[model samples]
Target: MKTWKIIVLAAIVVVIDQITKFIVVSTMQIQQQIVVIPNFFSLFFIRNTGAAFSLFEGAQWFFYLTTVIALCLFVYFIKEIGDLNIWTGIGLGMAVGGMFGNFIDRLLFGSVVDFFKFVFGGYNFAIFNVADIGLTVGIGLVVIGLIVSEMKKKKTVAE
Candidate 1:
């Protein structure tokens, strides 16, 4: 992947994530959630009280620590990404974008605006935002890439 392509992808993710959050924050009142889908899905807007699944709720300082660590990881990954691997480029781009998106939210509002909710049976997951989706999707891509690479390695070694 070209360096310019990586830059463009990062910018796109940042714009989309910020715009979506802007809409959510500006339109919806805090703690006042509206369910877009019933049962298995919904949009319940809330300033996340904790990390994913409401972990570490009372520790506001953890947000800063986590964001800094995430930013460092993104920088390291971006610098180390292989030039020809578009998948790696895209994956790192999404991760960086998501990291920054939530970072900005944390800086400005001290919390992220989470609206998407998924549930099944008696188990209920915490509400998440678009940034989390980007991050998760990027992680999925990376895992898939690693699996495919390993398979190819095994095949080559066996040949």
Candidate 2:
């Protein structure tokens, strides 16, 4: 993908993530869940006071510290890219935007806005926001890009 296209896609991800967070914060109650389809999915709202999956629950400072470190790594990778492969670009874009998105929430609200929930058979998952989607997709893209690139290299060597 073109550099400009990658930039545009990143901006879109950031905008969508922020807008959804705003709606969730304004419309939903804390821990309030509305089942979207029986028990498989739902829209729930909550402020995550800790890092991923509320791992360090109640430790607000943990989030602040990690966010900075993550943001640093995120930027480091983006800046170091020698060539922009489509999937790699998408990966970096999603990662950078998502990191910034959650960073905004952390700085502004002291927590990340989370509203999507998934559940099944006595098990429930933590709520998440669009930023999480970007983060996840970013990771997936990077992994896939690495795998595909490696395969291409092997094919060329064989030929």
The alpha-carbon lDDT assigned to residue 52 of candidate 1 equals 91
Off by over 4 Å in 2: none
Q: How close is every model to the real structure, measured as TM-score?
A: 0.83, 0.87
Off by over 4 Å in 1: 150-159
lDDT of 2: 0.81
> Lowest-lDDT window of 10 residues in candidate 2?
1-10
Error of 1 at 55 (Å): 1.0
- The digit string of per-residue lDDT tens for model 2 on 22-123 reads 888788889888888997999988888776678887777776787689877755665676566778888878876787788788889888898889886879
Score candidate 1 by lDDT. 0.76
Return the TM-score for candidate 2, rounded to 2 decimals: 0.87
Pairs of residues at least 3 apart in sequence or in different chains that clash in candidate 2: none
**Which model scores highest in lDDT?**
2
